[model samples]
Target: MDTILGVSKLSSKFQVTIPKDVREILKVSPGDRIVFIHEEGKIIIKKA
Candidate 1:
């Protein structure tokens, strides 16, 4: 099943805070690193 856990708006500084649900899904912490990839006309985000 495809679920939309969360969404965030881009800020003026081009930063978006990860939503709690999304953070939990990614299992990311404050100092954790994440990777953003642009593939197939979409942005893929994952924990690095």
Candidate 2:
């Protein structure tokens, strides 16, 4: 696994807001598409 850059609390709706540091690392903004990958027991998120 990579280094932990940020953290967020999951909401009751099963949703979590991405942290600002992570957003910066992903270079993403509002309306940007995000890709979710399931691998090795981890959920990987990336900008699409």
Candidate 3:
């Protein structure tokens, strides 16, 4: 599988928009739940 990298800015409301490339690669859609894991000083996001 190809790796995709994208950058997004966090909003004042503490919301961030997932980049299009990532969304497509992860096959995530609107209303889908995502999980964030904090490890080794980094955050990992996965489809839930």
Candidate 4:
């Protein structure tokens, strides 16, 4: 089953830091590209 890793708030500049657990799960690192998808009133992020 899926589980919630953590939560983050948007900064003044409209940026957010990915939680460590999520990043580890996604296997992303610095300089990697991430894609954002908008569907059904929800936003999804995926590694590109």
Count clashing residue pairs per candidate. Answer: 0, 0, 0, 0
lDDT of 1 by residue, 1-48 (tens): 757778889999999999999898899999999999999997889999
For candidate 3, write residues 1-48 as lDDT tens digits. Answer: 835587788899999999988898789999999999999997888999
Winner on TM-score between 2 and 3 is 3
lDDT of each: 0.91, 0.90, 0.89, 0.91
Please give the range of 10 consecutive residues that has the lowest summed lDDT in model 4.
1-10
TM-score of 1: 0.80
Which candidate do you rate higher for lDDT, 2 or 4?
4
Query: Where does candidate 3 stray beyond 4 Å?
Result: 1-4
Regions of candidate 4 where Cα sits further than 4 Å from its true position: none
Query: For residues 2-44, could you state the per-residue lDDT of candidate 2 as single tens digits?
Result: 7887788889999889988999999999999999999999998
lDDT of 1: 0.91
Q: Candidate 4's residue-wise lDDT over 1-48, tens digit each?
A: 846789999999999999999899889999999999998897888999
User: Which segments of model 1 are wrong by more than 4 Å?
Assistant: none
lDDT of 2: 0.90
TM-score of 2: 0.81
**What lDDT score is found at residue 28 in candidate 3?**
100
Instruction: Using TM-score, give the best candidate's number.
Output: 3
